[model samples]
Target: MNVAINRKLILNILLFVVMIGVIIFVIRDSLSEIFTELGKTSWPVLLGVTMFGVISQVIEGYTIKNIANEFNREFSIRDGFFASAYATFYRVVTFGTGSIVSEVIYYHKKKLRYSEGTGTSALRMITYKIALMIWALFFLVVKNDAIQRYITNGTFLVIAGIFVTLLIVSVLLILSLNINAQVLLIIFCNRWFKHQKLRDIVDRINNQVYSLRAAIKAFIHDRNAVIRVFCSNMAKLVVWYFLPFFILVQEHPTIDIWLTVALISFTVILGGVLPAPGGIGGFEFVYVLLFRNVVGKVDAVSSLLLYRYATYLLPFLIGMIYVLFNKQRQINHEFKKAKKRS
Candidate 1:
């Protein structure tokens, strides 16, 4: 266990280094350009971006609260806020994908049993991804012309096909999870693990998946809960996707909002496959690549900076501070409890 933990720590460090390196690489090429653009950004715009940053997280916390309440009665808005903040914070800091694990852990710490926490997190994950892809699909359709021209036929076809296929699979996966997660036995029953030791691990995973689905079925069975979850998650996503559009327009009014939405959303979902948490290096790389096509170097850098601060960096800082403050509060609460016991 200690070895496993150490390995995870090392891997996270490497990913963090990669993020830093990518940021440096971007800055290295256009150091003066990036700085000048940043300098030109006015204070009011930054402040507005900061407020939107808070609004985005608050909506996210509310969504988490909605789902968590079904399974964990003790769940409150305050706890939900911290959970959302911590989830974002850890996802930004931690290296590997499946950043929702942090949110699951947050739920467990607050009141949920492991199974309940993991189940709700998994359910929310499916819902959020479905919404994200839907948003991606909508924007892609609206900006199909620009996108197709931007990347020619063969490349465009392959990516669009992949996105469509993933959406189909995710829908099928959700159906299977709700009806009978054992549906996986059809595939996993085969001797795909290669070795007996690995086979044992696969068996363990099968059992865990079964348990997680059962927990999901318990609370998500309610019709109203399901609708609320979907609507809330979609709203949370809209705030995130379009918050930058507002900022970018303030900088360059003629800029194509749908184009910005299409590319950023694409890059965000595409960057998830990278090992970097929260799409670290790949996200900025693709954003700059896309932005350059639409605006000058100064506008490109400035727009991306505003977007990053409004949605990503500012949220990260706020989340980090919330986590630290919560940790300190937890310590104090524990000390008081111990003192009362004594």
Candidate 2:
């Protein structure tokens, strides 16, 4: 057990180092100008942006807590926050694959079953997609003319994003609701793959699919919890989408707030299409490409840098800190328990 734990720790540390290197490489070109913009920005504005980012995470934690309670799991708000933070940390370092692993481990340690953990994480993702789709559609309609005027191939991108989002949601629903689909999927895999090992993998995934379907049914039946989680997700998006506006508004006080928010929503929708971790490179590309038409090149880059700092970097750092602190606390707890036994 200790050997396995140590190996996992080593792997996570390696991933963290690689993630930092990639981030630096991605932003190296803009570092100088980003620093200049940071210098000009007031401390108060930076603090406000940071606060909003913190609030967004707290809301995410609340959503997790509510969802767990709906499932009869004994999860506290603090546990939710820590779990969400570590999930974010792993999500970044592992190119979006490690979030679920981290959450399942965290939830298991918190006394919840692994299936419960997986189900909760899956539901959180589904809620986020639903919220993003709703907000994206609303803003697309409200600022349709402005977005089309500024963004190249804006209509196509919006349509593509909507289609992609809808496709994902629809597929998840089908898999969860249709046992026939699950059976057919397993049968197809079995028929084509001669490897017993591959067949075992499919069987494991099929079992998890059963758990997820139960979770989806529970989530749907609890209408009030659904509303609460959905609203919290929307609140999180609002804070995230408005962050760039806050970063730029000090200098460009004449910037239209709604237009900025709408562009951000569009950027987020399109960014999801990219497989990059946390949508790092693709998100920056889309943000700069679209915002430059409205805010000019330099401001676009500067605001994006600051916005990334506030939303991405800040939360990630906080999560890392919490992870370290939690580890230390666990060590102390074990030491005390051992001492008492001795």
Candidate 3:
């Protein structure tokens, strides 16, 4: 038991260290210019825009709360906030898996069943991804030019292709989360490929997927709650995109906010596929490269830093406080208990 705890501690420390290293590596070349832009930034506007970060947290937490209500579960709104915030911390610290793990942990600590935990987490991600797909369509209509400009950049083309492919796969996976093994086999695989071992494995997976799907339908049964959660997540998406909007707003008043948001969304989607923690290395790299084409190098780099800080770092700090100071021990305790029960 002590050995297991020690191993987790080591892993946590390693992931944190890697997080710092990636951030430093990302900002290495832009250090001077980023600082200069930070110095010149309008504090009042910047600070005001920062509030959107807090608003985003509220919406995310509320979305979780709504999901809980759908389950008739007894999770508190405060726990909802911590779940959303700390999950972001997990997402960053643990790369990306932490978000769902934290959500499940939140429920486990509340003594809720695993299905509720997982269902709530899955619902949050599904709604967010669907909203992003809608954002892509809007981008195509309003900011086609921004995308067109980057089409000639080889890096952009590669990243774009990856993003599209992942988006398609993600959509399919989410839509098919409820599908049975037989249905999946019929739609995706052939009879020739089937075997006893494979069928057994597929059946086990299908059982879990069916269970999860039942949970999903239960949530959707509360029609008003479903709509509220969906809209709340969409609002969160809007506010998050605004962080980048404020960065480019001052000198480029003529700039389309949608265009700015779309590019930011593009960076997020593209960065998400990268194999780095929370898309750290990949997000920063592609964001800087693409933004440099639109704005100058210095402004592009600086704005990227500001936007990231507001959207990522700020929430991450609050989340760490919630997890480290308030909830981490409890969640870890619950995880251990659950493991023992199994």
Candidate 4:
């Protein structure tokens, strides 16, 4: 067991290193230009970007707090923020796979049951998806002409994204609310799969689905919490969508904020369709493709770099600091307890 644990730790470390290397390689060409643009950018604009970025993460923390409070009123905002930061760190390092695991473990450490933790994570994800679709649809309609004028295929992409998102939400709802569907799925899997391991995996998934169902039912009944979660997520999306505009607005004061928001909404929707981790490669591609005509190639590249820094790097760095500090505090507490025992 110890050997297995060690091996897993080593693998995770290697994966983290590899992810960092890939990120650096992807941005290698633009590093110089990004720095040049940074030098030219005003301090006030940079500060504004940083402020909004921090605000977005805090809102995410609050969203987590609100959700967890439904399950356990003892859950505090601090715990929520810790879980949020921890999840963000793992999400980036593990290419999005570790986010759910990270949050579950964090919540469990905070004394929530495993099922509660799982439910919290699952509900948070559902609400986030719903919020994304809502904002995407709203902006898509409000700024339809602007998006069409900028990108010839913008309408099609946004509509396709909305359709796919809706489909995913529908499936989750069916699984959560439809007991017959769940039973049939389990029965089908049990009959089709002969291997014990595959069967065990399916059983575990079924159990998780049950937990999610309970969470969905509870969350749906609490209309106030539902509204707050949606509003918080919408605010986060607004900050994210407008970040690039702020990044470039100093140089291009005439750039339309509404148009930028529309373009970003389209980019996010299309980017989410891709399987890339944290929407890294897919998001950059879509952003550049959509913004190049409006901002020109050089500015688009530079603005994207800054935009990425604000949206991705800042939150990640903050999360990393919080995680490391938490670990150190744990170690110190253990040492104090050991000393007292001695």
Per-model TM values vs. the true structure: 0.74, 0.83, 0.71, 0.83
Q: Against the unseen true structure, what C-alpha lDDT does each candidate score?
A: 0.66, 0.79, 0.68, 0.79
lDDT of 1 at 321: 76
lDDT digits (tens) for residues 1-342 of candidate 4: 555555555555565567567546534543455556667778898788888788887888888888888788888867776687788777776667888888899998888778888888988888888888998889887988866776667688788888998898787789889999899999999899989999999988898889888877877798898888889888889888889888878889999998788888888788866445653588888788778989998888887878876777666667777766665565556555555555
- For candidate 1, the 10 contiguous residues with the lowest summed lDDT are 26-35
- The lowest-lDDT stretch of 10 consecutive residues in candidate 4 is 25-34
Model 1: per-residue lDDT, tens digit, 274-315?
334463476676566566777766666677776766666655
> Which ranges in model 3 have alpha carbons more than 4 Å from their true place?
1-42, 153-179, 182-208, 272-280, 327-342
Q: Across residues 255-328, which tens digit of lDDT does each residue of candidate 3 receive?
A: 67766787876776666554555534788877876777777787777788777666676677687677555434
Model 2 spans with C-alpha error above 4 angstroms: 1-41, 193-204, 274-280, 333-342
Off by over 4 Å in 1: 1-40, 154-190, 195-204, 272-280, 330-342
Give the range of the ten consecutive residues with the poorest summed lDDT in model 2. 26-35
User: Which candidate do you rate higher for lDDT, 2 or 4?
Assistant: 2
Quick one: ranking by lDDT, best first? Answer: 2, 4, 3, 1
Clashing pairs in 2: none
